[model samples]
Each structure stands twice: as structure tokens, then as C-alpha cells.
Target: MNKFELVFIPGPGIGHLASTVELANVLVSRDDRLSVTVLAIKLPNDIKTTTERIQSLSASFEGKSIRFIVLPELPFPNQSSEPPPLMLQAFLESHKPHVREIVTNLIHDSNRLVGFVIDMFCTSMINVANEFKVPCYLFYTSNAGFLDFSFHLQELYNQNNSTAEQLQNSNVELALPSFINPIPNKAIPPFLFDKDMAAWFHDNTKRFRSEVKGILINTFVEMEPQIVKWMSNGSSKIPKVYTVGPILQLKSIGVTQSNNALNGADILKWLDDQPPASVVFLCFGSKGSFDEDQVLEIARALERSEVRFLWSLRQPPPKGKFEEPSNYANINDVLPEGFLNRTADIGRVIGWAPQIEILSHPATGGFISHCGWNSTLESVWHGVPMATWPLYAEQQFNAFEMVVELGLAVELTLDYVKDFHIGRSRIVSAEEIESGIRKLMGDSGNEIRKKIKVKGEESRKSMMEGGSSFNSLRHFIDDALTNLQEGNY
Candidate 1:
């Protein structure tokens, strides 16, 4: 009998887990020839606030018999603070033994084990696979644009801030339309600006190039063709890359993820009533938090735009009149006061939303987003035009690619320069916001919207029966299994 197994190793957050679990389901649904086990590493003590915080995706992994190898883990910071120093390096050193042991002990017979699927952060797990001499693939849930940016970080020591300055300072141009610099560097996370982040990024890019065997990105071909091309053969010694995604389609297999810990029913119902191309959907990924002033600016801009919208406001809750955003009750009160009253008739402000469902609804015209890769892909899958407000990480790159390269979305007014003393804190004003809204909600966005709708169709096509994503997935399984069957295991 032939068999295959994947070790689902996700990083320290819900986003990673969400992507991992969803992908795992995709792989499983494809055929009975494969099974997967999850290695859920917990963040200790710090997230003891609630059991819910601790097990972000444990319920999804339950009773599958694929085994949940819960490793006793470290405590990461909440929303703020740098990861513990040398986190990537330290995490590798600490988890290497556990990864090796779990493979050796819990996975039962070695003859049955076919391959390892590790997370991007779990590079050390690749080493364990090397020790075991099985093929290993690195899975990243972020956008291909972000991955493309990460791949270039290897040249940062030599590269300048041209990408950053242009994208952030109200300059949006695709450096290479044939290539996907999906988001701009400016909108990337401040971590990329930190000395620590720079160093770690440099090291990881080098490591990924040298060490990994294959790269599995959770995106589709039509979404970022340039990125897919670059990853497949861009740099020296990088592994084969695969683009297979919008894996949310796998939910049809009857695997349901628990609702995220927020309310979004109103957003969904409101969307249900609006006509197609009429309502704008606004959301900052769960990760984005803004000061009250910033929140007010965003809301005022939306109000001024006079567009019907469903805004998911997730700022840290305020206290008294004006409290520091960093000091919040439950992290949901960051919106400016009475601003909702001004737009109450036109907009619905909620604490959290069913973003994918909302995006899929016929009523959602365009999205005002922070451009997290998952959100980016979700919007693309739905053919929704975007007003890109990239807050951090590969968002800037995603924004750039969307507006300039793909011509599917518009990058709204936002400049993020890490440590520039001047103009580093610029917020897109209400007027610019309104204009962007009008563009996406009006005739100006129609052409872009139609193009993206076609692109989204292509994305789905890429994952259909004989499509690129589907074929790549099929080959990954067959190739891994053939290697195992040939006694390479």
C-alpha cells in the first residue's frame, strides 16, 4: 500500500494557522492518498488571557487522527513589542529537537511517512526532513507579492529605498509590469525597517534559497504570474515554486472553521441587501490597529466619500475621551467618536466581519483594505476592486502590484517610512479617501473591476480540474509519493 503524510507547521499567529489548516484540508480533499498531521506550537503564559487565545486552530484539527503534536512553546508579545531577540534563530534551535522527536515517535511507521510540509518559519523542520531524507516543502500563507518582496530582501544590503519612497510618498508605479512587485516596500511592516528584522530577513532569504527543496505558495497563477515566474526560477539555487490557492474552495469538503472571535452578522446581512457594485467593503486585517485620530480620519474620509459601505472597525477600545490606542480595553474602540452618527445611514461600522463571505456577496462593490496577502487573494478571488491601504508586512508590495502591475485596485493615500523623522506619520486625508471611494464605486472603477473580475475567473480556472494550481498540487503529491515508492524514503 502507498501512503503520504504532511506535517503542518504553522507560525505563531491565527493567520498562519488559518492558512495552514485550510491548505491541509485542500490537500486531503484532493484524494485519499494523503494524510496530514499538525504540529501546533503554543505561545505560553502571555496569551493565558483566554483558552481561546491559546488554541487558535486546535478545534479544527481535532479527531482527525492525524495527530496534534502540541509542543510546549514560548510566549510572544501581543500586538506590540518585538519578538524575543533572535527569535527565528532561537525558535529553530529550541524546536528542532521537538520536530525531530515528533517525527520519530508519533508518526508511527517510518515506511508510511512520505513527506514533510513545513511552515516558512519552521526552516529547521527542513533540516529534520534532511536528516530523515524525505522531500520537504515550505508553505507560506501570505501573498505572492509579499513572498516576492521577501525573496528580494537578500539584496537589501545593496538595494535602496527606491521601492519604498515611490510607493509610500504618493507614488504608485509598477517597477516592472511584466514582473509583480505586488506591494510597495513602504507599506510593508515596520519590522522590515528594524535592524533585527533586516538582519533576520537577510539571513532567511539566504537560507530559503540554499536549504529548501520546494516552495508552496497559497496563491493562484492569474493572481501573480510575475511572482510565480520569479519564484520558480528567479534567483540562484532557489527551489521549485508552486502557485495553488484560494484554498477556501476546500471548505466545500465539509470542514468548517469556527467563527473568528468577532461579530460580523450585520456586515453580511447589509451586504446581502445592496445591489451588485453598489456597496464598498472596508476592513483592516485583524492585525491593523490605529490611533483614534487615524481612525477618525479613515471614517471621516469614508463619510465624505458619500458611498454606502460596511466598515469593520477593529481599533483598540478607547477610554474616557481620548485614550492612547496602545492602551485599550479589548482592542475594539479605536474609531473616532460620533463619526458613526455622521455616516450612520450610509455606513455600518462593526467590530469584526465575515470578510470572505462579504467579499463573495454580490452587493460588495470594492474593498478598502490594509492589503494583507490573505485579504488580497480573497478580494481577487471575488473579483472585488480594492482601495489599498497597506498597513504592514508585504502589504505595501501587494498594494503596488495591485494598483500598478495588475491594474485591479487603487492604492489610497498612505505613506509608511520606517524611521523618517519627517512625513513618516502621514495619514491619507478625508478628501483623498472620498475620491478613491468615488473611483471604485463609480464609472472610473468599472473597467478595473471588469478586468479584475476576469482575472478572478482566471484564478478559479487555475484551480479547476486541469488548471495550473490543480496540476501542480497533483504533481507535488505524485512526485513525493513516487520518490517514496522508489525507496528514496
Candidate 2:
């Protein structure tokens, strides 16, 4: 049997790395002639956790034709004043030479280097892939709706020379093909309000259009049918688009033997005591955290709602530090006085969450989420409806999609951007939080719950043989093999 090798370069974040690794597992499992080598990038902070997770994935897939190789850590950049998007682009650019060296050795060892599957943030590595005469595919960690919005923004920049300042200053709604309703200006990603970040996104979108052989999105057709249909249509401006996902781990990873394991067991046991579909799960993504004021509001809301709940509350990292939010040393220090005791019988609060396990539990009725793409997919996979409280990145847009387009969630605050110096620009009041929680857990949520239950069934079916995502994966693999036969790489 002839052998083919593909190199994967995932972003430094855990969410990005996990999805990329899952995609690699899908590829090698489908085709015995193919193998994947993942080049893991080291994040400056939380190096230990990332390393351990990678180790765990490797161990879980022992004897598989997948390899995990950690790249040497580069010195942290000194440009503190630069916008974060530019800083990240420069940091990844510094890895080009290291990547070239590794790819060179892989080829010299008689491996038929076919392609490079790179994270969306690691687009700088595309130049290296070009140098090695291999095709490059972008593994977009977000949904197709967000990808379409990005392309729309880039088109506006190209055709009308629109600037971030102009977009931020105007209050116009955009009627993009990807969405059913006109997207309001407030729904745009907060990062795009900065001039430097807007330009960075424009450049990245240009590369996505002109450089990549294909773009792989982490969404299934049933989730975003209209947007997927629009992109997959024969369009000259867009590259080949593949929707091969709901690509997530079904079981929990990297928590079996750590402190988290004990915590996870307790949380699961607590859930076991609750009746089926009785608990509302509130968890923000890894970077999601809040100030004392916001935390107090959530606590009050949970108490007033009187619903069984599991809340994962994390403390923000100290100012001027490049670190993730840590579990509160004592969660009570920030929460309302006597709040834990008052809600003891009905709810539990913890630091880090074993999200997959919690969502899969029969007791989980609804999710109060930050609307991260990974969390959104996981919620759908487990048939849990959501209430959106988006904080950063493209989450605001995702919230709009869930509430307006798909009707899969209720809205808490679609455009809540956290200000590091202070708190949110406008604090979401406790009453508002309580209203959302009640709606999500009460009879008002029946319609949304039914929609999500059906969507969740479709999500699973999409991964089965002869389903949309399964066929999409087969199509992607066929294209890669065809390129190899044609000597196009």
C-alpha cells in the first residue's frame, strides 16, 4: 500500500488543538494509507496543561497512525503595545523556519508530503507550505456563519474601502447572504472595532480566499444549512468549502487522574441525584470570566430562579498577565454573601468544568453559555437548549445565529463585551439574568428545547456513514488523493 503524510499545525489554544486532533483521528481512521503528524505549538502560559492534554490524546489513540510533535517554544514577543491580533500573527510567523526544517526532514525520510492542515490563526505557516510545494488547507475552528461573516467583511473592505472606524461609527445593519436577518452593527466582533485588528482580519480573509486549497469548517450542514449552501455553491471568490464536523470528543479527556477528576466525580454524583432534565448548567469557555459585580448578579439570578444548577465560575487573570482565568481560590470571596449556603440544596458552584460529561448527563436541562463554537456544538450534540451570554470574539455573532436564525437558544445578552479595566460597558442586571434563566428552564423554553432535540439527532446522524458530514469527509479525502495522483502538491 502506498503511504501519504499530512502535516497539521493547530493554534496554541486548547479548543483549537483538540478539534484539530479530532479531525486527524477521523482522517487516519477512514483511510489506512494516510497518516497525520500534528505539530503542536506551545502557548506561553499554561504550557503544562496543554502538554498533558496532548499526551493524553496520544495515549488514548495508541497504535493509531497519528503522531504528536511539540515544536520548540519561541521567546515571548516584547511588543506589549501592539494589538493582540498583530502580536499573534507575528509570533506564528517566527515559527516558519522551524516548520520548514521539520517538513524538509519529513520529505527526506521518503514520506510523500501531501498537504498542510493549518489552524485559522496560524495562516502564516501557509507560506512555509507553499515553499515545500504542498497544498494547504485551513481548519477553521468556528462555524460556517462566522466564516461567511468574515468573508463579507473582507469584501466590504475590498470593494468600498470600508474601515473599522467607519463600521463602528455607523449603526447600519448588514444583509449578508449567510444570515436570514440583517446583522446589526452591535453584533460584529469587538476586535474588529480596532483598526489594526480589522486590517489583520482582512489580510487573513484574503489569504483564506487566495491561498488555501480548501477550508474545513467545524460545523454540520443541518446546523447552518443556508450559510453552508451559499458557500458551497460555485462561487469564484471562495475556495473549496468543506463542512465536516460537529468534530468533538464524545467523552471527557485529560481529567482522569488529576484534581479535576475528583471534582468531576462529585459533580457527576450530584447530577445523578437530580431528576432527569432538572439542572441548568452555566459554564463559560476557558477564557470566560467576570468581575465581582457580574458574578454577584449571576449568583442572585440563580438564587431567585430556584432551579437546580451547576455553575462554573472562574476568576479573571491578573491585569497585564498572559494567563487564562483560574479557578477562584474560594469561590465565595466574589459571590454574594451567604449565597452558597442559601442555594446549597439547589445548586453547586465549581471552578473548572468537565463540560462534556455535564452536558451529556440526563439531568442537564439547559445551558447558560458564552456561545463559544465548541460549547455550541457540544450543547447541540447532547440535546441541551441554550441561553446565550456572549462575552468576546465571534461569540456575539454566534448568539445572534442561535437566537434569531436557528431559534436554538434564548438571548441573555448578545453583545456583552467585557472591558478589562472596568467591567462590562453595561452590566446585565440581575433581573434580566433571572428572566433568561426562567425562560430557559420553564415552559416558555419548550419550543426551543424541541428544536434542539431534533437538531441534536441530526448532528449525530451527520457523523454516521452516508450522512452529510461523513460524505463531506470522504469528499475531502478524495480531493487530497486526487491532488497527489496528479502531482499537484
Best by TM-score: 2
Give the TM-scores of the predictions, in the order they appear. 0.82, 0.97
Residue 409 shift from truth in candidate 2, angstroms? 0.8
Determine the C-alpha RMSD for candidate 2 after optimal superposition of all C-alphas. 1.7
**lDDT of all predictions:** 0.66, 0.88
TM-score of the candidate numbered 1?
A: 0.82
Highest lDDT: which candidate? 2
Task: Estimate the overall C-alpha local distance difference test score of candidate 2.
Answer: 0.88
Per-residue CA lDDT of model 2 for 356-471, tens digit only, reads 99999999999999999999999999999999999888898899999998899998888788743223657888999999999999999999999999999999999999999999
Off by over 4 Å in 2: 256-262, 419-423
Model 1, span 1-489: residue lDDT tens: 444677778775556666777788778778776778777765453234223633534455564434556666654333223443344456545777878888887457642666778777777677788887777778877666666666655654446532333233434333432363434445555555456556666666666667776778888876777667766665534677777787663221222222223245545666767777788988876556565666677777787778888866654433221111122333335556666577767777665566777888898888988877778778888888888886655566667667876787875744543121121356667777888888888888888888888988988898889998999888777777777778866
Candidate 1 deviation (Cα RMSD): 5.3
User: What is the Cα-based lDDT of residue 264 in candidate 1?
Assistant: 51
